[model samples]
Target: MTARVGVVTFPGSLDDRDAVRAVRIAGAEPVPLWHADADLKGVDAVVLPGGFSYGDYLRCGAIARFAPVMGELVPAARSGALPVLGICNGFQVLCESHLLPGALTRNRSLHFINREQRLRVESAGTAWTGRYTAGEEITVVLKSGEGRYTADAATLDELERSGRVVVRYTGGAPNGSDRDIAGIANEHGNVVGLMPHPEHAVEALTGPSEDGLGFFTSVLAHLAGTVPAGADRSG
Candidate 1:
């Protein structure tokens, strides 16, 4: 069966369509979900695509947190029944909603950053990253203002020890994210948040590399019972 992945679109979202296209390229069905609607459209997984939701007012993803859909998503994600991936602004939402730990702060330079970023796979155990081995380097585009990831020392230490830090800047820290983190996952490995835009890099003709496609594909494979919810958890 083909997996149905839902891509959410908020008021000011710019990447929802791109996320849908990426899911299609990964051989899964893309389901467009509206933020105002409480219905999830019954997708196997969910993606909160990157964008300035609610105009990024008060803080990114803050307003969008109260959306009705989150009421459903939080439980599904916590149960490990539905896999959730949050990209860029989506990451902001995850942090705001407490689905994922830590917060995305402004860049140390306090400027919007847009560029292709190289990242290393710090943890391959998440449902979103089963295709890559730990320490593998991949390039994906990152564009955002509040991109820095920060956590208290205790939280950071736990993330490191638990192997939940899924991705990190390879060359060096970008935007001053602690431990060069580019992505992270929850304890169940069902929820993941990354600062880069993977959906923008799924097609060969338009995508930066085939690398980004792996994220969508990995989720499909995981649900297919081929992987024990991320068999490549080897770090």
Candidate 2:
């Protein structure tokens, strides 16, 4: 059976369709989930696509984190029962929900940064990154005003020690994120949140490169048991 990946659509989400398309492209069935709906429709995995949820008014994802859909998602994700990937604004939501550590603050320049970004895979063991090799580089589109990832020094050290820092910005930090961190995963490796829009880079014709397809394919591979779970740690 094909793995069904649900893409959640918040009120202001802009990349929900693209995320669904990426899931289909990766040979998984794409299920559309709504922020207000408490049901997941029995999806095997879920993706929170990028967009300015709640107009980014009180903070990027503060409001969306409390949406009805998250009520079910948070518990499943934290318990390692469900795999979840959060992209761009969705990353903010994960942070706001405390599913992932650290918070996304505004870019040091305090301007919207939009461009193709190069990132190095720091961990390939997570449910969303199993297809990538450690140290492999990939390019994905990143567009956000509050994209800088920040956390207390102790928390950063703990994440690094636990091998949860999944990806890092290559060459330089585009948004002044500490240690050039671009992505991270939860302790059980079922949850991942990244600041770049991998769904936007899945198609060659529409995106800068097709490198981002691995993120989707990785999840499928994990579900099939083709990839080992919670073992491959970053060096």
Candidate maximizing lDDT: 2
Give the Cα lDDT of each candidate: 0.88, 0.93
| Tens-place lDDT digits, model 1, residues 93-127 | 99999989999999988888888888888887888
- Taking every candidate in turn, the Cα RMSD to the unseen true structure, in Å, is 1.2, 0.9
Over 50-157, each residue of candidate 2 has an lDDT whose tens digit, in order, gives 998888879999999999999999999999879999999999999999999999999999989999999999999899999999999999998988999999999999
> Candidate 1 regions off by >4 Å?
230-232
lDDT of 2: 0.93
TM-score of candidate 1 against the unseen true structure: 0.97
